[model samples]
Target: MNPWLPAAPCAPGTCAAHTGRTRLRPVAAALLLAGCAWVLAGALGAPFLPLFGPTRRERLIRRWSYGAVRAFGVRVRVTGAPVPPAGTPGTLVVANHISWLDIPLVAAVLPGRMLAKREIRQWPVLGPLAARGGTLFVDRDRLRALPATVRALAAAMRGGSRVVVFPEGTTWCGRGPGGRFGPAAFQAAIDADATVLPVRIGYRVTGHGAAAPAERHAPAGAAAFVGDDPLPASLWRVVRAAGLTAELHVLQPVPAGALPDRRALARRAQRAVASESANRSPESVHH
Candidate 1:
């Protein structure tokens, strides 16, 4: 078992439902409030955001994100040192792709725009809100769009925006290593002469402050947004489950000058994240 997350009384759902129910009223309220925050962010916040400036919008988003995560009943834990705030000279974060929760988990800690798949832009409330929040979308499947995407990302980086990119390109269940990091995204950092901060994400279940002896010690996949997993189903599973925590291992930042090219930078970032994921569980190591 990973020492950082010792076997706790919470084994995902055992007895956690009772706790969830006990606090159901407050959690529900928080969720409603979170939803309202998003709506306001889209309607009022983003539109008049420039009048207040990026800092205000960032603070608002961070508050909403933190509340949203709490409402979902997932606690986020960070390991290693924190990365520089967005707009820092060289602040690009590259993380592993796991659950849809990964976005909020990171956003709550480090507020900035994310590099997401084109399809996410069409997602109902999430898509619109994300766009209004400054998220940059890319059509990964279109080769022609790659250059423009990278250029846009680089420009954002140069402008001092903290940009997050999941080099894995796609999500994976914490079952094994995720898809290979496409070198394209690394160009943003390269072009901007920024450092790539590598972050590894994993999950654990809370046991309502009780010791969960029945814990199986397996990597929690309940929150994983893998293939064919419906968003509604995943959200329900996560929100209803008690004591879910996202473990973020923020590895050392890989400087752009240290790597010769984008591909090298991509491989280095992937290895850093994969290594951290492997450290989560002995059998969880990547081949």
Candidate 2:
């Protein structure tokens, strides 16, 4: 009955009833853990910064991300292979941007420093966490900032750490392609001679351990942070929605060394994500 809740579920029989039930407890748990996580991250992370490496803070972040995803009551099923565990050198991860949840989802799956928009670094609790967790902030509005950002990212990649980047620049509804990826970040991998890992993020509805294909790769009633949708409103929608699932497909890695140019690398990563995204549409399935 919450105003933020979507209309009744579309599935037939008991599936509809099950889908209509909102999981408020998970949301509550997530909120509580989020508060604790941030507080601990700031309080504990700062003191140890001089002693332990960045991985300590990253580990804490990863734990919180896993908890947050569970709190959403959504199951994340990962397909394809992982891109060599956390320490592999010269690894650059790129994925399609969906909901703000994509942040935690990626953190939960691939623990690494994220290339986030400058705005995210200014958010409330997230700002502190991102700062402590080693996020690379970019001012998308400043053309002059691109080269420096690219150079910094290149240095980070070459230092033997995984860097996750959303090449789509901005978020989009999973119903279609997320637009062309900018070649600037790809230049980082090219410069560092890193392995480009293309990842596709999609949504689905699950019931009785089976998934129903989403409309435009987004499950019916799935949460999407697109357009002018406010963060609170999106969170409300997510908590109210039922049977939601996040599918993270780690597509094959493209070697940046073999690419002719940064443009070629960008196009290849975009194609991998876009093709996988299209594959999740209704037409891809057989009757």
RMSD of each: 8.4, 8.0
lDDT (10s digit) by residue, model 1, range 220-267: 666777655677656666655556667777678888778999898898
lDDT per residue for candidate 2 within 51-72, as digits (tens), equals 6566665566667676666565
**Where does the lowest 10-residue lDDT sum fall in candidate 1?**
1-10
Residue 112 CA error for candidate 2 (Å)? 1.1
lDDT of 2 at 149: 98
Which runs of model 1 end up more than 4 angstroms from their true locations? Answer: 1-44, 208-217, 277-287
What TM-score quantifies how close candidate 2 is to the native fold? 0.79
Worst 10 residues of 2 by lDDT: 8-17
The global C-alpha lDDT for each of the candidates, from Candidate 1 onward, is 0.69, 0.70
TM-score of each: 0.79, 0.79
Q: List the residue pairs that clash in candidate 1.
A: 8-212, 9-211, 9-212, 10-207, 87-160, 206-243
lDDT of 2 at 188: 93
